[model samples]
Target chain A: MYRALKTKPWISLLAFAAPALVFYVIFLLIPTLGGVYYSFTDWNGLFRSYHFVGFSNYVEAFTEDSRFIYSLFYTLKYVLAIVILQNVIGLGLAVLVESRMRTKALFRTLFFMPNMFSVYISTLMWTFIFSTAFPQLAEKTLLHFLDQPWLGSSSMAFVSILLVSVWQGAGYLMVIYIAALQGVPRDLQEAATIDGATPFRKFLHITLPMIMPAITICAFLTLNGSFKIFEVVYALTGGGPGYSTEVIAFNIYQEGFARDMRYGYATAKAMILFLIILVITVTQVAVLKKKEVEA
Target chain B: MRKRSLIPSSLIVLLLIIVTIFFMFPIVLAVVNSLKSQGEMFKSVIAWPKALQWENYKYVLTEVHILRSLYNTFIITILSIVGIIFCGALAGYKLSRTPGKVSAFIFFLFLSSMLIPFYSIMFSLIQVASGLHIQGSVYRLPLIYIGLGVNFAIFLYHGFVKSIPRELEESAQMDGCGQLKTFTRIIFPLLLPITMTIVILDILWVWNDFMLPLIMITDYKSYTLVLLASTFFSEYSTEWSYILSILVLTSLPVILVYLVFQKYIVQGIADGAIKG
Candidate 1:
């Protein structure tokens, strides 16, 4: 057997890859395939038997389930808000920090510090701020607007979620943008300046295009991340005020584990989510890659 | 023109200062109020405490067994990282060097799964875990992490291995070293840069991940730091002082690690983003 394996290089390759492959197959690959198969059945997670249900799960989720449909739109809104706001603020901070002569490192560290905390922990801290600090501040200071129900109303809850997400996320994109900004050729900026170009013009025409790849990367990161947001909403509002802030992942978690144990139905919803993410991300990457090449 | 430019530049600095304060607000507030008694905190969340409340930290530390949770997190993180590095490095090295459809297909198999979101597989994954009797076991959780993490690690290692010269391995082979020995002695040491990248990134994920531990680990003894802090928060939801202290204690280690390895962490994020 050893001699035969020695003669065949592919067998040795399998040997080398076998350890990782074993774990990956058992834990990840099997789960993924099992998820897809279970999506076509009516397995409620407890029974030893289940029957195939074809596309009923998909049709029901689309045509019948209002909560699931609402979550889909809500998640899309979240994705758009996070992608745009995170990149803009991140790039803005990067440009501003880079302009600092001596305090650049200090600012970078301070900005990225919040991201060091777990999302759960960050949400806890913000909960204190919203529940305790804001009301007290409103009483003490003249800033009456700070007294509003930041996490109570539907609109405010949406805003509050976006606020925390951006606060934790923007700094990461800033690091990427800072790197991209540093990679911008100093000579080109000098040339533009010498030609009497305003700083804004120099940034718009020169810096922006030079950092387009970083923009694409940051956008991709935020888009993928925001679509699957679970912990913040889970901990913060608990999808409060009648599920107004329910993201897709949270809705699926509710279906599969928390509320109903319809593992099959939840798996179907999960597949839909996977397809949406796959399609949107692939399209974004293809379009961004084209732009990156042109730039 | 110089005078006019100075105005906007200074204005930018002023704006930055305000934003920095805003960014630091939650952390500063948490830290400040963590030291106040609940009554003192209620008086004014922003005001200085009249008396220090070290008891909040003491209560969480002793009663809640937060230190044990921290140790549990450390053990799981280190073990999973070692497993990932070992498995990922071997498979990535062999697959990169070997030329064939089989190797390409195996590599593709690993790479394609990176697109599958964790939520997509998590439900069925729980079923698999329970079937294997690994659910709720702290020591066995790293195995699942290794499975989930190795794909990305393999991708990184595959890209990094290309830069290593093949002659190093060939020369080791000629010296009568077996393939495994050659890999361990020659190729493994050279993969340190990418290995560091993987270790840093995985440490953050495993240490901070809340959902997996929440679902898998039913026993409080197996609770990770984040999980314990979360449970503590929900139970003592109204006790701002105790909850704030727990939050601070939980975050202190990560903040310290980030401060000590600031440059490497930043570099790791950039490298992972660019390469990945």
Candidate 2:
């Protein structure tokens, strides 16, 4: 029977995984290796001749690169703001819909609607609302104070991106949290209520604890997405107002293709960004998994 | 205590209303602006149109080759979805069943790519793409779509496949069905919900994708809807009525699909991102 067992699990696994494996290796893994290799050389994106200059790319990017630091700081600011706002508002919307309310589906659709639009187009739509419609409305409504150069001003541009990001994302996150809220077992809520638990107390004791896993997931997504944001910022402002809105992705994009070629250096900056994200994502996922267990 | 709780509730309501108003602002403005004529647009941006210009949408649909662009988007999106579902489901099926370090390692590599900011290697990928002899033709978009899409598809497929019992697959194999047949006949049907999720998610994404189409496909006539709309904005940035109409037209396909796969999308999103 043992000799008759001619099946090979490894071969089957290899066969099963081949399509994804081949595509991944060609498109993703190959490019990643190419990135690491090119980071050492000063290859003009369009040129053929290249000489390796090890560690120089990374060293210069860290110490001599002013825009790199600015990009880092700018991205961190956007990440901090978007990470908090997207989650708070999303969680709020989720809790509201979970309250056995009327028009739940309607609200869900309205909220989730923006995620369906392409971010670039959504940014364009917001650009109209900001530069055209909002200003257009500011003339008639008593809310004359609402109009401004939302995409133009260096300061207010932050708020403009933040508003669009939250509008586009919060609803999707709300739907995510809504699912977790439903899974919370109504009996626990009822038990807390029977024990003379106030709404706040019951929520603090039962609801919050139970939804920590959802919170972790939402926070992770928001954080991951916000730091690497490019499309919305590109569409909304194009990192204008003296490039004050420039984040790391846009900066890398400009260095790579949007302007004069710096493919090697651009890849270096990209690598740093990747390492930073990889570290944070791993740490957050690990810590959150632990908290999910402990809670 | 009850009053304090009520206060927080009202505060949350206020916050939500403010956010909702901001969220709905663009859609409302698009609808109203799409109703206005060119004269109406410049005369008073806030003023109501004397008569609705329903012709704006008609113009976008017919003259702009909005229908053609929609066909192109539909082709790319559907192909990408089929590719994603096949490769994702196949890899997911084996990875979940086979308990091995190699399989687990491959899964982690795929998952980690999701974290790497796409911009990191996006330029190089485009270079490789453009270097391909057929890259200039409309052929390259599907390759790009598959390249970017598989990461998330694998994520969704892996999660759902784990929940499916492996005994079902083993039992089917005992009856002498080939792996491919077992997949199509047995596992594939069982994966309907997750398939729905992958299809809808991919549709929603690839249909609306603009930046890729913008950079990769230089041929103006062969553009996707989102790319067409963006280029339209770039050329006639001041054409408020036309732009608004195009926006409405562009959003329809996605909203239609969303209506059909409503539960799958909402639930899959929850399972994939929110619930972990």
Candidate 3:
């Protein structure tokens, strides 16, 4: 046995891979496969038995389920907003903060401070600000426009969710953009400056091109995260104002856990989300990667 | 030119400071209001409490058993971290060292699975967990975390191990150390830096994670810090003092961890995001 093990390298790989593979399979792999399988079933999650429904669940999710379609559109809208805004704001902050000589680390820490809190916690805190503090500020100060029903109306709740997400998430992307910005050669920027390029010109020509890779990563990360947004909507508006703020994940969650134990149906919706995210992120990454090479 | 630039630069600094306050508004507000009576908080959400109402915190701690929930969170986070590092390092190191069709295929398997969102598998995961009789137990939950978490950790370690020279491990093996011994004794120690990176990233992921814990843990006693705070907030939505205090308590550990390991956490995040 020992001699055979020594000769066969597969044995060694098997030994090392087993521990992780066992857990991965049990927790991640099996469930992933099982989720796809169940997506075709009519399992109510009560009985051991389930019948194969064969794409009806997917059909129901798309055609019959208006809420699902609404949420899909809403989530796409959110993903678009986040992908654009978070990257822009994050890149802006990163550039601004990196220009500081003495206070770079301090500002980075302050910006990233919100990221340390759970998304749930951050959203809850913002709920108070929107629900209570905003009204107070609007009442007593010049910020009267803040007195809108931040979480009580559909449009307002959408804006409220967007604000909280960007507030919590921009800092994270900022950190990434800073790291990427530091990679751009200092001499190149100095040369551009010596050629009488303004700071904005230098940034646009030299700095932005250099950080394209980071931009791609940030865009993908933001895309993935915003598509999977649950905590913020759950905490702030609870997808209320008549489910107007319901994103795909929240809708799936409601189906499986809250509304009914429609495990198979929820799994189908989840699979749709997975496919959407996979296709979009892959396409975005591929396109951005080509940009990186060109730059 | 110098005079003109000075105005813009100072203006930029002033703008940043203002934005900084806007960023910190929720946290500062939460902390300030947590220390006030409900009546005092009602009078002015922005004002410093007339007197520090320690009872708000005391009530959360005593009545809500915040410490117990903190313990549960720590137990899950730490154990999961330990498991992830060990399993990830072992698998990553071995996978890196031994390159062939099998290893390549296994690595690809992990890499592809990274694209599978948690929600997709969550419903089925619950079924599997209940079937395995591991659901609703705090201790057993981290085992699932290790499974869910090890992929990224492995991805990190697999990349990191390529940087270490193979000669050191070969020399250790020549010294009569078995593969496992060579890994634990010789290879593992060299993995400290990347290990620290993985540890910090996973701590942040596991500790601050809300969805998985909310799904796996059903019993009140087993609720993680985020779950507990969320449940409490929903139940006591009107109790601002109590809710704010619990929010502060829930967030304090991660904030402390961030402040203490600012450099590593930041570096880890950058590295993890770019590489993984």
Whose TM-score is greatest here?
3
For residues B111-157, write the lDDT of model 1, one tens digit per residue. Answer: 99987888878888998999998887879999999999999999999
Each prediction's DockQ against the real complex: 0.59, 0.53, 0.62
lDDT of 1 at B122: 85
> How much is B206 displaced in model 1, in angstroms?
0.6
lDDT by residue (B1-276, candidate 2, tens digit) is 222232355665676577567678787777778899988876666667789999888877766888778888888887888888888899887787778898889888888788767766666777677676435355456766776778788777777777778788778777777777788898989988777777777777788776677767777767888888888888878787988898888887777767776767787777666414
- Displacement of residue A127 (Cα, Å) in model 2 is 0.5
TM-score per candidate, in order? 0.96, 0.93, 0.97
DockQ for candidate 3: 0.62
Model 1, which residues run further than 4 Å from truth? A1-7, B1-7
Q: Candidate 2 on A46-76: residue-level lDDT in tens?
A: 7889899998999999899898889889998
lDDT by residue for model 3 (B1-276), tens: 221121267877986898799799889999999999999988888888889999999999887878889999999999999999878998998898887888999999988899888989998999899999888888889999999989988998999899999899778776777788888899999999889889988898899999998888889999999999988987999899999999999899888878998988999889888876
Model 2 has how many clashing residue pairs?
0
Off by over 4 Å in 3: A1-7, B1-7
- Report per-candidate TM-score of chain A alone: 0.95, 0.95, 0.97
lDDT of 1 by residue, A1-295 (tens): 2343254678778988999999899999999999999898888867779899999999999999999999999999999988999999999888888887589888988998888889989998998898899989998888788988888899999999999998888889988898899998987888777888888888889989999888888888888888889989998899987899999999999998887688899999999999999999989999999988998
